[model samples]
Target: MYVTQASWKSEIFQVTVGFLPDRAQIGALGLVVLAVLASWVVKLRRRLAYRRAVRPGQPVHAARYGQGRGADHLGAYAPQPGPDDTRA
Candidate 1:
C-alpha cells in the first residue's frame, strides 16, 4: 500500500497525470515559438537596415563588382580590339 502511494507521487506520474502536454512541455514549446519569432524580427530588421544603407543613385551590386566608368573598361561595352592581334 505504501509502495503504491510512493509510485503515484513519482515525478513522471505527477507530470503526466491529466493533460496531454504539461506546463513544462507547454513552456518549452512557447520558448521555441518565441525564438522563431525573434529570429524573424532580427532578419527583417537587418534587411530594412541594408535597404536604407544603399546610396540613392548607385546600383546594389556596384560596390561589390566595382563602380562607375573604370569598372566597365574590360567588360562587354569596351573596345573589341585585342592587343596581341596584328593586322599588317
Candidate 2:
C-alpha cells in the first residue's frame, strides 16, 4: 500500500481531507463506553467489598475512630472558619 501526505500548497487536497469520513469514530466511542463500564464495575465491587468488611450493628466510623457513635463524632465535613472571616 502506498501512503500519500497532504500538501500545504494545494487547496483541493485540503478540502478532500477536511471532508473525509473518520473510520475510527465508532471504535473511539466503543472504547469510551468500555472505560465507563469498567469504572462503574470497579466502584461497585469496592462498595460490596466494604460492606462485606463490616458486620451487623457495627458503626460505620468505628474502624476509623476506634469508637462508637457520639455527639463529638463530627465528620470531616464539619465547617471551619477561614482566617479572614469576621463572623463570631
Candidate 3:
C-alpha cells in the first residue's frame, strides 16, 4: 500500500492544492527523430515494392501515358478541328 500526498498539508496554509501526478519527462527530439525515420522507412518500402512490381523496360503507368491526351488510337479517334485554318 502506498500513501498518497495530501491535497492540503498545513492548517495555516489552507490554499487549494489539488492532485499532482508524478510523470516522466520526455524530449521532443527523440520523438521527432523516430517519426522521421518511420516515414523514411515507409517511403523506402513503397519504392522497393514499386520497383519489384514494375521491372526495367516496362511502362509503369501504361494507361496514363501510353495513349494519353491528343493520342490518335489507330485512326479510331481524330483530333478536333482547330478554329479556321492556321493560314490567318
**Number of the top-ranking candidate, with lDDT as the measure:** 1
Question: Which ranges of candidate 1 are over 4 A from the true structure?
Answer: 1-21, 55-88
Instruction: List candidate 3 stretches off by more than 4 Å.
Output: 1-26, 56-88
Sort the predicted structures by lDDT, highest score first. Answer: 1, 2, 3
Error of 2 at 53 (Å): 0.3
RMSD versus native structure for model 3: 14.9
Q: What is the alpha-carbon lDDT for the whole of candidate 1? A: 0.67
> Which residue runs does candidate 2 get wrong by more than 4 Å?
1-21, 57-88
lDDT string, candidate 2, 1-88, tens digits: 9998667655664454556466655565567689989999999999999998885886574346555344235667645557895643
RMSD of each: 13.5, 14.7, 14.9
Q: lDDT tens digits, residues 1-88, model 3?
A: 9997655544222232212222211334356569989999999999999988877776565456555445445366766547984521
Ranking 2 against 3 by lDDT, winner: 2
Q: What's the C-alpha lDDT at position 63 in model 2?
A: 46
How much is the lDDT of residue 24 in candidate 2? Answer: 56
Provide the TM-score for each candidate, comma-separated.
Answer: 0.40, 0.39, 0.34
